[model samples]
Target: MRLGPGMDYAVAEFPVPEPAPGQVLVEMAYASVCGSDVHLVDPDFHRPEMVGSPGYPGHEGVGRVVASRADGIEPGAVVLTVPSGRFGGCFAEYQALDAGSVIPLREGDDLPHVLMAQQLGCTIAALAKYWREGMRSAAVIGLGSAGQFFVQLLRARGVEVFASDVDAARIAFGREAGARAVHADELAATVAQAHPEGVDLVIEAAGLDATRALAIELVRVRGVVGNFGYPEFQVGTFPTMAAFRKAATVEWFSNAQGEPGQWCFHEALDAIRTGAIEVGHMTEVRMGLEDVPRALAITAAHGEGAAKITIAIRPESAIFEGS
Candidate 1:
């Protein structure tokens, strides 16, 4: 699938990528749309260079290693291949990924739902570096998949998470995930009335200017703000002066910041496997690669009724064999 500006997506048969040295050629079985993908498809973040690139914006996926030029991982291994590049090849039949970007999983790893681990790993990676002691209260702006994960992680640490989003369904998901959830329109007032001093930490997961600013505003003096989502531009202006005035600590990082060892991804997979993170409610998938455009449109609309919009590229409940 080739993506273009203004949500234009076309299905074109492109040549399958070849494995480079230390890379694996994966036969993609499932891929999911991410909040970042919606941002990339917008006219504001369009890149002409990627106009005709196949699978240019998808990064979350699960597949089987069809062949490998790398050691340790071999053919037939089922894995999660989530390349951290600006463009990804998971939307295609096969994507050639660096050996390190693929996390090997069990042959019986749940389909479609297991795909949720890609985003979970991202939240796990970013959160591991920012979470700390004495953070009693938090505000997560955006109850998307990433924001929901952040709320769960924070609540697990005994932090009172006040989560907000424009969508009603997601607000319910946040509440179900142990957050004191609210509608976006009610966030500021609700937070103000509940915590006059503001929350201890605020996570900006919506990546919009207003939400980013709200994260800073909702944090207490000397509190921390973690920017975890992809903004409209590669370069976005922050309320530096406001943060400075409050003596706040701003931690802005990417999900790929510590992806090399795959330890975070391993942790995420283990969590899912052990039922530490239940993804049963997140598995709503489109049938095939041809549905990429609609999936993107639905996700971009923000009322898709699915926590995650995934596309199953191939058939069969069992898509892999133990390597």
Candidate 2:
């Protein structure tokens, strides 16, 4: 597919890829649309150099191994794989992946739907970084796919979670996912009334500059604020002074290059397997590759009513089939 300034996506036939040494060829089963994908499509952020040789733009995909160089993962095994860079190729029918990037799906575990695992991993990493010892109360700003996961994860961890979003439908979805939902404008007061000391941890998953400032405002003094959202535009004014005076810690979480270990991905998958966290509700809309452009448009324009919109690559298969 080619993504340009005035263009959306144009699918074209290409030669099937063959795995090289230490790589695996995956037959993609499902791929989820992410907020960052919307940013990449924006003309302002799109860079000619960032586009790959084959020019595929997907990072979150679950697939079945068609061929592999590794010994443990069988050819028939299902797995989740992410591209090493921005040009990572998950949007295609077949993708070549390094063995290290492939996450093996256990027998009887869901395979086709590993997007949940990928998303859950990101959320768990953020929570693990900022969840505090004295965190009796928590709040998550934004109820997108990741935000919804954050809400469920926090509540599952025994924290009383308060979720806020500009979209009312998302707020309701948060409530359904076990969070006490409130509007973004009303979040501060609502949380203040519920916990005078304020929430101990506030997670900014909305990926908007304004929400970053709101997170700093809602957190208690000496508390922690975890930022899991990737804002498309540069952040103008963060509440630096308030954060400093309150002795708060601001942590940024990204599954991309900055991290050294793959601990978060493993931890997230395990949590889902054990039922410690649930990601079922996040997959609100499921479409095929042909519907990707429309799905992306909906996610970018409509912030609520839909959480995680996944593209089903394998016919008659769930995103996570074995699991």
Give the alpha carbon lDDT tens digit for every residue of 1-323 in model 1: 23433445778898888889999998888898888887776656766677677886788988888889999998888888878746677788788888878888776678676788889888898887677677889999998888888888887788988999988899999999899899998998889999998898899888888888898899999998888877757666778899899999889877572566767777788888888776777776465798888888888778465778878887644455433
Per lDDT, the best of the predicted structures is: 1
Q: Candidate 2: misplaced stretches above 4 Å?
A: 1-7, 52-55, 256-261, 316-323
lDDT of each: 0.81, 0.75
Each prediction's total of clashing residue pairs, residues at least 3 apart in sequence or on different chains, is 0, 12
What would the TM-score be for candidate 1 when compared with the true structure? Answer: 0.92
Q: After superposition, how far is residue 266 of candidate 2 from its true place, in Å?
A: 3.0
Give the root-mean-square deviation of each candidate in angstroms. Answer: 2.4, 3.3
* TM-scores for every predicted model: 0.92, 0.88
